[model samples]
Target: MPRYDYRCRACGTNFEVSRPMSEASAPASCPDGHDDTVKLLSTVAVTGAARGGAPAPPPAGGGGCCGGGCCG
Candidate 1:
């Protein structure tokens, strides 16, 4: 199962739920009971390296005394 994020248009609430990918886009209601909810695209954070995309910003102080040149 994959986790999905949903937002309620009627009540302006946000929440996350884990469900099958086939049902990820189905109509989901707000936990508060509102029926006019919409699903939102998901996002994630990368820690050390980029996951098939552009590289992430170097940590504060440039990663170490070597100034991030070691990986290159």
Candidate 2:
């Protein structure tokens, strides 16, 4: 089931509903007993290097001047 976002036009309420994709077009009633509602365009934000977020963790193991390749 996917989550849907809705805003009650009658009471100005913001809410969400989880239902099958087939029912995505179905009407939704707000918890405030309002039948008039409209689906909202939700926004999702992801945090990572792609989104200019914090850097990734360093890799495990040890390294030297030549990366421990020629010295040892």
Candidate 3:
């Protein structure tokens, strides 16, 4: 189950609700029993690079110091 964040306008309290994706848009009440609530926008963060794809080759003409002949 996914958790949804909500805020109660009547009591100015924030809460979370766990429900299915189908009910994502459904109305939720705050813990304070306030029905005047609104769902808060959530942000997702992606960490680490994706795997399985071949690594990209170094830039042409060797742009880096080690590849551009700077260290050589």
Stretches off by above 4 angstroms in model 1 are 46-72
Q: Write the per-residue lDDT of candidate 2 for residues 1-72, one digit (tens) a residue.
A: 789999999999999999999999999999999999999987887666733576765444445555556667
Q: Name the candidate, 1 or 2, with the larger lDDT value.
A: 2
Which tens-of-lDDT digit does each residue in 1-68 have in candidate 3? 99999999998998999999999999997887889999999998765534766656667777686667
Q: Write the per-residue lDDT of candidate 1 for residues 12-47, one digit (tens) a residue.
A: 999887889888667777899898877887788746
Regions of candidate 3 where Cα sits further than 4 Å from its true position: 48-72
Question: Distance (Å) between predicted and true CA of 15, model 2?
Answer: 0.3
Residue 61 of model 1 has an lDDT of 53
Candidate 1 TM-score to native:
0.57
Ranking by TM-score: 3, 2, 1
Model 1, residue 66: what's the lDDT? 73
Quote the lDDT for 44 in model 2: 82
Q: How accurate locally is residue 23 in candidate 2, as Cα lDDT from 0 to 100?
A: 96
